[model samples]
Target: MRDVAVISFSQLLVDKAEANDAELVMPVVREALGRAGLQKQDIGFTCSGSSDFLTGMPFSFVGALDAVGPWPPIEESHVEMDGAWALYEAWVRLQHGDIDTALVYAFGRSTLGPIEDILALQLDPYYEAPMWPDATSLAALQARALLDSGRLSDSDKKKATAEPPKIVDGAAAVVLASGDRARKLCSRPAFISGIDHRIESHLLGVRDLSHSVSTEIAAKHAGCFEKSPTFAELHAPYSAQELILCDALKLDKQVTINPSGGAQNNNAVMVAGLIRIGEAATRVSNREADCALAHASSGPCLQQNLICMLEARA
Candidate 1:
């Protein structure tokens, strides 16, 4: 595999927005490209993450392609998962050694529809989807399990149960370059030391909601436990889930958690996980952290997880 680093990242989040998906995505794409001192054509490959279900239209991501200006015809692909998975795909593409640089972006307008109902569609159609359980209710089931599992203290439980999630509109863009290409793009780059993702059984009842086995496996494969991370950007949509991730990752109080206030501050659906990665990269690029961990998740109640470890070298 080739050495790859996060050269530039940009993000925007709003409680409510009137702009279309393409309109919202364009600015961040421009910002990331501009920060990397590159133009659209300079990007060797491009990938994006978004959901047509949220947009209530098919090929909604195709329309967002205009945001990247595919007029000259650029190599691109889209994932129905979070933008973090898009970054994962770009990382793999870069490893092929055919591309020196790639652009990854994700956008979502959760305000467009009933987020709870839309997210419920992600559950098993035969068992869970038919029941039409909302996102919070499902999460609450997990939270209740964790509380009763004897894994958390009274204060931790109180902190976990504080408030509900607030869905927002958001988008994020990241520029990745390999080896020498990375050095030319930025003075300091957050080199991707390792990255991996894992998933668990889809059936909520059969899985252990109190613990994130997938996160532990992904983090181990990503080499996150090789050294203590100074910071962690976890894509926990709820406070209880954040606690679950902390335990799974084995993070201590000395480690900074969610300096960006996490998803609870701005839950942007598909975009939040990518924002976590961008936030961690920014810390490394700025020399605030020598090593950091960024995590993203898909599926209900933390059924799927991706962990990426980053390091800054002088």
Candidate 2:
């Protein structure tokens, strides 16, 4: 397999943003490209992640292309899911051997609408969506199950200190390069040693919410169990979910989890996952961590999960 590494990353998070999506993405994209010592036209491919549900407008991501300088026309793709998926797509594109570099970004303004209501739409239309259970409520169900299962004691739960996720507007971008180009772009590129994603049964009733089986499967496929990472950036919006992820990945106390505060600090829907990845990449790029684990998730009750193992080049 061709080696792919994250060369540069940039992000912005705020309680709310007065600027539109394109405006929110422009500066971060510029910063990421600039840090990689490249220009807009120099990019080989571009992919973004966002949702139209927040804006109540279809094809909302199309407008964000203004930030990537689409004037000269560039190869691009978009995912309705989180930006981490877009990064995955970019990594796959790099494996084609024709492209040496790619740009990946994601932006979301959860404050634009009732985020809980928007998230509830991800549930099954026939069963869950009709009931309109908010994201927090669903997460609470998982927490309750975990508590009852004896995995999370009152003290353990209290230690984690579950906090209501902050609904914020944010944008994050990362630059990816292949092999030698990665070395040229950044002194210590965060190479993607392994990455994979998995989804459990959509019917939340059949699956065990107390633990993330999907995360474990994804972690196993991503080689997360091969070696321990010094840092772990998990996209768990709830403290209980974080606990579940730590258990699923078998991370020990030595692993520093969410040094950037994770999604609970700033949950911007589609953007937060990419921010976790960017944070992990930045830690590796700066030599703060020799190996790192970055995780992203979507759907209700941690139904979908992605794990990316990053390591600093020798």
Encode model 2's per-residue lDDT on 1-314: one tens digit a residue: 79999999999998989999999999999999999999988899999999999878998899898888786889999999899999999999999999899999999988999898888899889987999988888888888778777766667777443456988999999999999999987999999999999999989899888889989999999999996799999999999889889999999989999999989989988999898899998999898998999999999889999999999877
Which residue segments of model 2 deviate by more than 4 Å? 159-162
Error in Å for residue 209 of model 2: 0.4
**Residue 2 lDDT in candidate 1:** 83
lDDT of 1 by residue, 148-266 (tens): 89978878989666256888999999999999999988999999999999999999989989999999999999998887778999998889999999999999999999988888888
Give the Cα lDDT of each candidate.
0.92, 0.91
**Runs of candidate 1 exceeding 4 Å displacement:** none
Q: What C-alpha RMSD separates each model from the true structure?
A: 0.9, 1.1
Question: Residue 270 of candidate 1: its Cα lDDT?
Answer: 90
* TM-score of candidate 1 relative to the true fold: 0.98
